[model samples]
Target: MSDPSRHPPTQAALGILFLILATAFFAVLDTSVKYVGAFVPVLMAVWFRYMFHAVVVTAVMLPLRGRSLLRTAHPRFQVLRGSLLLAVSAISFVALQYMPVGEFTAIVMITPLVVTLLAALFLRERVSALRWVLVTGGFAGALLVVQPGGNVIGWASLLPLVMVFTYAWFQILTSKMARTEDPMTMHFYTGWVGALLSSLVLPVVWKTIPDAGTFAILCLIGLMGTVGHFLLILAFKRTQASTLTPYLYGQIGFAMFCGWLVFGHVPGQLELIGIAMIVLCGATASWLTARDRRLPVEPPEA
Candidate 1:
């Protein structure tokens, strides 16, 4: 007889669809950030994003989980993780001011590659030679996307690289925390931590919204970010990370579409090739990871 307590097999297709929707929401969030970046101070824009995120999560989650919503075994690590992610968002917004969204996201996608290296170094995970080769190719792809000799090369181009490294560490912390914390609890802390930290600096950088339209856009930024992250959590719950990791590359397509539709920018040939390399390498690395865990691996198209 089937054990009623055992969880059912993961719904891979549903997970992929959730991930795609998450990506679309993220793309819209970025578009909103880039749009508001023109009118608001970067710090203020970031503050509103997090402040509203905290408010929304609290309103929804606190009622459901009550005091348990604030429970965490490692509070310091949670704060640091949220702070690092805040930094990534702030830096990315600044970079978006000067770069196209698609290219910036392509660069940020290197976080997976960096995470592989960090896992080997810090987590002491066994990485095979083939995976190492894939990581190396991912770096090459990043270089192609950056193109030091090309016009796209500038200080702004470096911001996403910084964000990626910080994000890699953030992911490591998240991996650790996921072992002991409820996803909703973690999400709650992320929003509050970011909101609280940014509030500390708001006194020096506050900017008033000049109109209702801009205020509405600011709210949209928070709504999209909160919803996107929630969808991502839901996606992971439905499938193995390895099964879902490859579909993350789908973000590139969504980002590209949003960039062109909003800004009339299309990636150049070299940039497109670089994106392909990064996606392929990252997907392979994720597959190897799943295989190491003895989980069933699926193709990118699957």
Candidate 2:
């Protein structure tokens, strides 16, 4: 059989395609969360999201990888990682109730910038002047999206920012764990951990589906989250992350399109400018990270 990674050009192209498609699925996941959040309690929705994800991943991977799928060197870190992502999902569900899908997505895309900041502060990693500038510009862009006195102000606006920080830490931990852990094992543990943690509160938040349509949407949320991260893993396997990093910003565009299509929400001029800035700065930072060989090839939490 031909070696899949031998042809750089072909592998890169496939990686880009998979990354873009993964972003689309993430967009769908967010849009569905926003839609379903209105009818379902946020915690309940979160539980369903993680539960479905864990169940599906278990069903699919068990047969293929057997018990090896459950092995992990850092079991405690896996739980911590999963807990952080569960926090992210809960925060995202609440945030979406107040923020537009596109704008929320744009703000979350600042994660790479935040990661740079954290690495410098905690890891004592030296950062370049240009990267610092990009990081500053990226947050500035986020400020534009969640401008002061805007509709997304107050605690609601702060949610995604909180998510960025939480997710930044998650990314840092994942990068550390990826050095010694199987990606599939990490993926499996993350799902189950989130599911189990959220289930602790399920009894308080659980409610009837209200209708079949809502149940389907809940399932769609799980499928999108699972498939999106799975595709990200496939993309990284096929090609290097630096080559695929820039296209990750495509999630913002897909999200904006989904927002407009689903909610008829068009961003104002300033929001558009901010979104553009975030995309530019984030993509540039990722490129620089790749050039410096500092970018870790790991799938992000959905």
Candidate 3:
């Protein structure tokens, strides 16, 4: 197998392809999460997702790396990162129950902008004024999507916002820890930590899956999560993070298509406009951040 790490930094074309695949896989993963959410208890669905993630990772890694696969230099941060992602899954899954997948996906796309703004505030990074404008417009786009009184309201809409906030923090933690930890090691711990923590609530919330079909969907959810993330990692290895950032927006289009095909739903005029605004602003912010900071020569871990 060719080592992606040795690939030229300018593989923008291949990176876009890989990123598009990653987003498509993620869209499928979200669809499965939504499917399982319909029949499974939210907590139980999340637990199963992580539990199966841990299972898949362990099954693949233990033989190749032996017990070393379980070791981590930063166990605390690993656990925290895993816990944060579990929160994201739990909240986002609930949002999926009530919101259209495309709109929800578009709203969550604000994560990169939120990360940039948070970096400026917490990391004290000097964000150019243009990037700040982009970030502001991103939020404005999110507001248009939510449209407080238009239709989506109450707890349903807030869930994605919460997911966005937590996901931004998750990315910040990932960036910080990426400096010290192996990506595979971090991936391993993320699965196990989430599985272990979510297992605590399984006893109370666990319900027997009604049939083999639901069982398969639950398994598919876990499988897709792991695979989607794996593809994301591979894409990063092959090309610069900045080069792949724009392609990530492809998820919204995939989500929209999936929503229409599976659920027979389409966004309204305002919602479509909001999704466009969010995509444009978020992509601009991502490009500016990459242009300004010049991402590390080392490939970013997903």
Q: Each prediction's Cα lDDT score? A: 0.78, 0.86, 0.79
- lDDT of model 3, residue 165: 83
Among these predicted structures, which one has the highest lDDT?
A: 2
Top of the candidates by TM-score: 2
lDDT comparison, 1 vs 2, better candidate: 2
Compared with the true structure, what per-residue lDDT tens digits does model 1 show for residues 85-161?
A: 88888888787887778877777776767878888898787777887899899988988888875776477678778
Worst 10 residues of 3 by lDDT: 293-302
Candidate 1 Cα misplacement greater than 4 A, ranges: 1-11, 290-302
Which pairs in model 1 have colliding backbones?
Answer: none
lDDT (Cα) of model 1: 0.78
lDDT of 2 at 118: 95
True-structure lDDT of candidate 2: 0.86
The alpha-carbon deviation from the true structure for residue 283 of candidate 3, after best TM-score superposition, in angstroms, is 0.8
